[model samples]
Target: MQSDPHHDSANSVELPTPTAWPIITAFGLTLLFLGLVTTLFVSLAGFLLGLIGAIGWFGDVFPHPKHEPFPIRPHDEWPKDVCRVGRTVTHLHVGEHGHREQFPAAVHPYTAGFIGGLAGGAVMAVIACAWGYLVDQSLWYPVNLLAAAGLPELSTASTEVLKQFSLAGLVVALITHVTTSVLVGLLYTVLLPMLPAKREWIWGGILIPLMWTGLIWASLRFINPTLNARFEWLPFVISQIAFGMVCGFYVFRSTKVSTQQGWTVAARLGVEAQHPGEKKP
Candidate 1:
């Protein structure tokens, strides 16, 4: 009663649908553009942090299995189940020719991490920009600057004196970088999955605006009006559309590429795998 490796488990005779590429290409192009647009503001650190998250997510997926593909026995007699959790696959059966991806399942960890972090960073960049505007006003900046900056913190300087020094401005900048980095990294690791998959069309589209708007709104509602005045509250979510679109394109294309290349989507639910260390195939 085992199924053919070439066929899908659902129908026993059907090939799993190949992924659609148009969506992916569009998404990737969109991201590249968004990355360009965001070069205007935000620290580079946020993108770097987001990249780490992405790399980690992609690297451990579908490790290389060592066992050869099954069916040293007849196709019908091949062992249907080979993969288990925490197992490492080093080989795979590719159309009767034993082939391999030539890399560990952890391939491109840094690249994935970098890109994921970039996205995470981009989002946080927005939040930071929005929130920074709120934080930059009046006494708050001076207080935080004195505490966070080196010279100001070490010196018994008056608030007026501290405001004139380089340390205060530097501290604010450092705080900005740290806040974006952490926020973006957290966004990638924690928030990304909570939303629907990136290409869910209706949900994905609406979520972009909804999220940015909420962040912007939250910034305004909580903060003093004086600070909010400095913030450039451009169509709030208009920029986020580019971000969302970019993420969408990656999800669509990367997913398709994985399928076309005989890989499974890491984000998919309960999908089984066939690793290389099997005794039968």
Candidate 2:
């Protein structure tokens, strides 16, 4: 007797059964970490939940994986296609210009990013200094605060000490500020092109600043307790916005270069042989 093909196909189409063990394990892990911030009781509860979940999850697969048989519908019960057919599909060659469907076919050069970063950093410094002078009556206060991230001495220094100028603080602040600005500027070059063209400015200038500010606000306590203690949210936010706006505008105005994504590795490395008839200019 011949076996029924449909029956065999249906029997072979077994899928893994849905289980709550994974979610339970995830919740357990979350609580376990959250306990670091809260209390040991939560961690104990999480450990119990995690152990139970792990045991149950392993039981599903130890000897044999658990699966459920999926019901197969007859061909006659399948939905009919209503869309038009036989439309010609256009094929793209790998080396062809603008053949990629992904956004950002081009990007600003590294030079542009570097210059933009410097410009933005200058603007940000100006704003920060102004805030320092206006609010703390000292031009060195903000600089000292920034340097405190690296200088442990400054971290514990008195408010009066922060207000006084220190050559070491100035050097540290300048280096930190420049390095961070340039890195963020390079990131902007990569990010801005992926955003909607019309809304790039809004995202780069306002939204991005606010987002990083929130992140810094949350993490600052652990990263630098001193800066977190004396940190003024308003001034810091303003300086960040100023940096973003200046950097974004500069990069936006700079000329973009085609990405070499479509080029062959040899061509990108300038090792591809030129065509016989091609003239070197």
State every prediction's TM-score relative to the real structure. 0.30, 0.59
Tens-digit lDDT track for model 1 on 1-281?
13335433432444323333334444444554566757622324444444554454344332521122322335677678876789676666643323553322222223343464456446545554444346443333333332333343424444444344355555665566445444443343334445557445344345754776677568663342433433345434554554555443333333211222233343233365553221221
**Model 1: lowest-lDDT 10 consecutive positions:** 252-261
Candidate maximizing lDDT: 2
Candidate 1: Cα lDDT at 221 = 35
Backbone clash total for model 1 is 24
The best candidate by TM-score is 2
Which tens-of-lDDT digit does each residue in 52-108 have in candidate 2?
889989998778677766777877877996888979667454334434423344578
Residue 38, candidate 1: Cα error in Å is 75
Q: lDDT of model 1 at residue 57?
A: 38
Report RMSD (Å) for each prediction in the order shown: 27.3, 13.9
